[model samples]
Target: MGSEPGAGWEFARAAAVHSEVWVITRPRFEPLIAHALAAEPVLAPWIHPVYVDLPDWCLRLKKHHRDVYWYYPLWQRLAGQRALDLHREAPFDVAHHVTFASDWMPCGLTALPPTVPLVWGPVGGASYVPVPLLRWLGLRGAAAELARRTVTGACRRAIADRTARRAQLVVGLNDDVRRRFAGTAAVVVEPNAVVDPAARGSSGSSAPSRVRTAVFVGRLVSWKGTRLAVKALSHPAAANWKLEFIGAGPDQRWLEAEAARRGISDRVTCRGQLPREAVLAALDAADAMLFPSLHDSAPWVVAEACAAGLPVICVDLGGPPIFVRGTADGVSRVVDVGPGLPARLAVALRDSESVQRPTPSDRWSSARMPALLEAWYGQAAQFRAGRDAAGNGSSVSSEVGGLVPQTP
Candidate 1:
């Protein structure tokens, strides 16, 4: 499953462990949900999925990537109405908005009864590629970044502000997002990527080799910093590392050509897109993960890499740094984004050999999520109770309690 669906499924499973969860999602996922529930019959009674979608005509608008901006909000509006009806039938203690985890996007669930506290997020999207680093992105990628910033800025002011104000608790996916919602809501830093304990790698399973290997597991897009990785690999400091690209995109040809031009074609391999199992197998065989996404809110690959006991070397801009923060000393390297990003990354790559593999007890493990969810839900319920006791007419405060401090 992709990050969005995977996050929804994980959150639903975790939430269901404590109380009944009614997941409002697209109708297409119903079959998958049914299949998953059938496989885990014990969770069937706890999970009640409510499918809500727009008409076929409206859904067609989402055929293209850009059209999703229009389609998602409409879907949220419809889902909000459905949630209202469900709440009327049987009142809910707390409501959480999980998927479509961008903070700039408006959540229609804010329309729920004022008495019922809402937990918004594991949300992100506030992270951006620094201005000094924009030179790395080609003309088209730079233009896209500009357009994204413009849209996000407008939406944050017009939509996100209101939603944050109304939410009793806002679960930010990264420090960037937590800072964005700092005074606007009761914010907590918690990533949506949770590693399955059973899938965690055993110690020495991915033992070091004479020639170190670094794996990149996202799309081969310019904004994803694949070109940057290639440039970093060209540096003498990282000459011993062989880089493998495990995804396919428009930049694949460019990456191959660039690697050849840089005279490191022998050390670089662009292995187009692979299956999940194949990706995991590749991680098992590699020494480290290099994911320098320009402005990703959260990339599931980072958490998966950590689970595989691979040290991660990522740009210090988004969710990757947060995910790797809890790893043992030298287990992860967060390169700062600036004029010499490639050089910094090259040095980090060279140093990765001495790093330790992350254990299953790290913060990203799924085992820790149940307790976190329980605490968050309890906080939301308490916030609601306090508000009710103060009287329904009492205005909601921008700050509630249970704010988790971010590690420096």
Candidate 2:
């Protein structure tokens, strides 16, 4: 994975164990990757680290803003050059681009030789906050969503289209991307892997709380639907319950004021961003996860909340629903992102007691990712070799032969 110091590290680390991985990432991740390799001595030979220094302007720009999405193409350009250099020395098989985890951001590796099959994503770009939902957000919120869509559209151009055309296999975070890039190569959907296996076990079985407590564990961003979660508490069914927000963002003040305006401030607690352990602890104590994000592409919090055995209340769109299990059995609720969200969320909160925590499957767990990824790598390699043998091949959609579990 190209470095962003998040889920990409987990995927790269796990892939190292099963395949010869050359991580073309930023220099900042060097220390962490070194420590991880030192901890696992056997991975030392298999995983190769290649760091690329971003331009001074790029680095400064990225630091100044959260949506430095355009900077990624430049980063990938450097990575592509580095990858070509490395491939010449080692004669690599398949080239996989792991991050800048957006389908709209074309992988630089896709520009590699056609014989070197390219695997793109487990990324997302198709999901967005519906225009109808914008009214729920205030002026600033609406503007933010508009800006996001505008940028996303600007980014989805020739480069990304070409990258999609060249990929031997494209792994989408959810069906949104799969549908968007439908005619482009074989598309498979699998959300990001749950990296820490130790975090898999239940956060212990506990009796139902007399007063249900729902937790929202993402940045207090507009699209996260944090306000919707707070507004839901105003519903009579969920009025008795409290909402604990556990992250910080630009919209923190707005969320707080909204809660106050709704007269639910007494029940809402914003615990800012805490350490990983603290977040998990909060999830363990909460009865349900209120993650009604309008546009999310495989959020880690959903997996973490489920790992803690907390039922999730996510929207019926994007990646959250794909990850949330047992929707039929009430383990999770996928509410529509519209005017009725508060009421639907309230019902989910009321039924939180009956919601059953889903068992984490091996396919979705990070521990088994090495195996799953090895299979993908093998397939990608075989496809590359087969195409080379045939002299040439056309870019056409093909059946996803022998791919495991249809969804994450």
Best by lDDT: 1
Q: lDDT by residue for model 2 over 78-159, one digit each (tens)?
A: 7777777766666566677766677886577754577677778777878887888887677988997798788777776656
TM-score, predicted candidate 1 vs. hidden true structure:
0.92
- Look at candidate 2 and give me any clashing residue pairs: 122-171
**Please, what are the lDDT tens digits per residue for candidate 1 over residues 283-322?**
8778778888888788888888777777789998878888
Off by over 4 Å in 1: 198-209, 355-362, 392-408
Model 2 residue 290 CA deviation (Å) reads 0.6
Instruction: State how far residue 55 of model 1 sits from its true place (Å).
Output: 1.1
- The positional error of residue 210 in candidate 2, measured at the CA in angstroms, is 1.7
**Predicted model with the maximum TM-score:** 1
